[model samples]
Target chain A: MNTWNVAKLVAAKDLRIEARSRVITNQVLPFAAIAMVMFAFALDNENDALLVQVAPGLIWLATLFSLLILVQRSFAIETADGAIDALRVAGIDPGGIFLGKAAALAAQLVALETILIGAAVLLYHTEIRLGGVVLLVTTVLAATCGLAFVGTLYGGLAAGIKGRETLLPLLLLPVVAPVLIGATRALEAAFGTGKAVLADGWPWLGLLITFAAAFGVVGVLAFGPLLDE
Target chain B: METIVDLRDVVAVLGQFPALAGASLTVLRGEIVLLQGPNGAGKTSLLRVCAGLLPVVRGHAVVLGHDLTVDRSGVRAKVGLLGHTNGLYPELSVRDNVQFWGTTVGASSGEIDAALDRLGLSLRLADVQVGRLSAGQKRRTALACLVARRAVLWLLDEPHAGLDAEGRDELDAVLRQAAASGATVLVASHELERAGALAHRTVQVIAGQVHEVEQ
Candidate 1:
């Protein structure tokens, strides 16, 4: 296999492993969904403007939490059977492994985001207009990219950390905050929701892209060192 | 006569810990070199550096004419590794696991099947999920990946620890065949007597340092 081919193989392997385990479904996704649903319920009666104002952060935060918690499952595949060492010894590119894992994580986060969006509409009684859809999808993808990139590294590092169950969140949040900030701001732009032109979004989207790109490059370069560690 | 593998006084340090130090080793085309060492002897670390999987703080390593420090991506394509973990997709059936790794290593389906045939796994365990396989079978399946890969260098780490007699023989034949076919083999094994049968030369390592042991 070539570059993307190896990535696909690695990602598909991760997905298959995730399917077999159900850890993502049982632990991370459900808790995140419940958290989102509860937040929407808790604030259902508050001032509409206030809820809208915070909605961007709340939604992105929930999604980011879920991605951070769940995406570690992708890394678990390697740490479980010592597959990371095997892959490294196989002379496989750590970059390919990272991208493959990030890809798998992106797929899982997209699914979870769709579930949350549905929950927001039906259970939470949140509304989505034309521009709302654009903003939501953009926020979901951009945030997912940033979290997936950062999470993969920490998840691998956490494999060695003492209190990984508790420490993973602490290790991940600070590194990923910039991406989170840019994404939250971009989603906040959807507040008034009349026209919300793409030009208005161009900068935030650009920032999001830069964060994702930087995370990708930096994550790839740095993960090798962490793995070697 | 080409040197498919070369290493020159390789010193690799991980922070304060020394992983491999003053490690000079080589594997010419079709040579089978058995690497035996106790735990923490840098056996895995040495193989990893050779495969370009680990960073070497000093010294140079080249595999198939690709430098470990510089042209790692190029060298990686020409090497196959079967470590203690030995690349297995537990969720996938034996066939699928083989096929997926084949894709990553750029081996064709026919080559994978032939590899399985060489390992005697082509018929019995084809459809079984890899997770269900026993330890020896997992090791065999990993070796199957090596057969399928047909790379220039085969890095086998602790490949024969849990195998039965037949399994051990099978792995021995696999290594011998790979070496005979002009693929340099660097195996780090705990099974010394068994390895003595197949290895052309044996090199010992201790606590991240190399020692010459002719047995």
Candidate 2:
């Protein structure tokens, strides 16, 4: 009945399952790193300036694709054995379930993004300036929250449907376009990729905050009905 | 006797298919009622409706003093529905699965242990992942979870399907014990000979309508 308590329980359950399964470490993370490598090779150049200029968008792009895999894996666990129905019948607050799932996803995304950022610096010769560190952290956190909330909401929407594997990306990609654009632009400003300043990136952070807040509220309200349907 | 379930002309649909076409049934407290019907005769739908998992499109329905048509969610915590799937997380251990469901109702660790023990999951077996267990063991684990929830209403669909002879007898005993403790049970089972012996009454569901079997 207590929403916070339920959220904690559900989040812990999901994290524990993930820890035991090792799927992210064994599969998804490597896939993301490999995607970064593939992106570097696709440009077909040893020119460090070009790779550095494009690294921000490339990192976020890898994160987005990895997010699709994470969301699918998250819901797959629930639908595999009707555990979602059991959760509904158990009378756990759906809002709490939404928060819990989103939180776990945000945590995973943070880890994935951290690795991807490091990959960018290593592979693309991108510079992380001392002045931009604060804005970069803020951008990653806010963007992760927005992506997690939207991913959980859309994942629940597409759950239990036949061919949801194909449907989820179609439904999710359009909704997340703003996030991709916002995060990339913010990161570009933070990295000073083109002639941008840290002040310019702060405004994009505002957009990311609003996006996260808006989707967070909508996910909590709509998740229950979506699960029921 | 107190009425635990009351339905009149309840109509429920699954994407345009009227799964419960104006079906009516009444069940009292502490009664074990068997629902007999062929496949797709609305038996599962009826149980789902009682468990508050299905919406009543038209008609009046109430379970545990909660008017389902008004608010079906209120009855969910007090009822347990065991459908075809065991609803167990394959990656979780037996104890973890039972504990997770049990904690929803605030059941303590001791109660979880007792439920696992009641279902013959020893300490060794309780530590094993449910995915590795046999079909019969998974069913038992599911039953253990239901017991741990301390549900007032039991909605079991083909509960005895995957059990061996001994497991089947054990399941029947568990149901009888639950009934003795004043819990109402509605079981949709094809094994009439076994379930009929355990039920106090039997009702036939034909074409989404209920007919008394006159036990």
Candidate 3:
């Protein structure tokens, strides 16, 4: 019917499928948890000061890797049974489909971030502060949106190709460099020992929001043509 | 006659190869036409072109009153294509898969059940995941989805490939019923004798060109 309603339907389908399969929770979650632990080992767990210093960058890196998996799985699920063809001809607007996919991916990212952040705090012994919580949430949301937008676009771009697993990160990493940097810097400003980068995380948050808006709009507009054979 | 599909010298390229090299065909409303050809003869490509999945880079191609050159998305909602892949989610139940397609086209819940029942998928199998079902059952589930959409144009590619005798008979009845209900049907199959039984006319596709086959 309506665009928003259609998007909800698509998102609901993906979430329902994920809930049944538990691929992300059972497989990817453990992989990210182990990755975070490895990062701690890499930084030398005895040195809490250095661990805190690099936790922000490691968190973003873990999220990026997890995102690559999530995006690839999202497209792979559709590749089965020629579902992509069904989707193209199903009468739903391509933009609606793109929004639905991006939303589902964003939801998965939220889960991954929560788990990875929890691991980072416990393993890395990072300090927690109640201040700047709003900015932290804003930064995460903006960055998530940006990643999901580009992920969905490139995921669609790489569908049906044999080398998509290797191709997606190649297509996505360069475009998403700004997101990783902006998000990490914002987190560092919020949680790092260097408390005087700027008054607030506003500047980095602004960068994240701009990236989100630009890529989000582009993804919606380009999804139809990208999926067309 | 209301022509649902009209392709004139349409060219579709897949990588460096031209799948539809100057192919042309027309299908009217409520007609069941069989498309027969060898492997790589472009039967699948022609069906794809009709469904607006393949872009026509040259000449004229139209479906459901929308020009493919201008925008193919306009015709997608009104067309249902059942390709080689069943297009069902392996993790999702039969009912869920059917509902996904149904909801995509805005079909009512009642209509969804009726479509499933028409394809002989009982209530028991409806809740079972598609991955657990046999190939025939999966095909039936996909056919249920196509029926649920109630689309005006139906493009079936090798629809009877995996089905047993009973399932084949059921599909034949479904095709006849669909045409009787005024939906255009185009089926591509290598099973010439069986496919011919369901067609009012047959068209041969050779190297992406369409020619009428004498009955």
Docking class of 3: high
For model 1, name the residue pairs that clash. Answer: A1-B106
Position B185, candidate 3: lDDT: 97
Name the lDDT value of residue A198 in candidate 3: 34
Considering every candidate listed, which one attains the maximal lDDT?
Answer: 2
| TM-score of the first chain alone, every candidate | 0.86, 0.98, 0.96
Candidate models: Cα lDDT each: 0.75, 0.93, 0.88
- Comparing 2 and 3 by lDDT, which wins? 2
List, residue by residue over A142-183, the lDDT tens digit for candidate 3: 999999999999999999678999999998899899999999
Model 3, B1-215: lDDT tens digits are 89998999999988889999898899999999999999999999998888888888898998889999888778888888999999889999999999999988788999998998999886689899999999989999998999998889999999998899999999999999999999999999999999998899999999989999999
TM-score of chain A of 2: 0.98
What TM-score goes with each of the models? 0.85, 0.98, 0.96
Indicate the residue-level lDDT of A34 in model 3.
Answer: 86
Ranking by lDDT: 2, 3, 1
**Pairs of residues clashing in candidate 3:** A81-B87, A91-B77
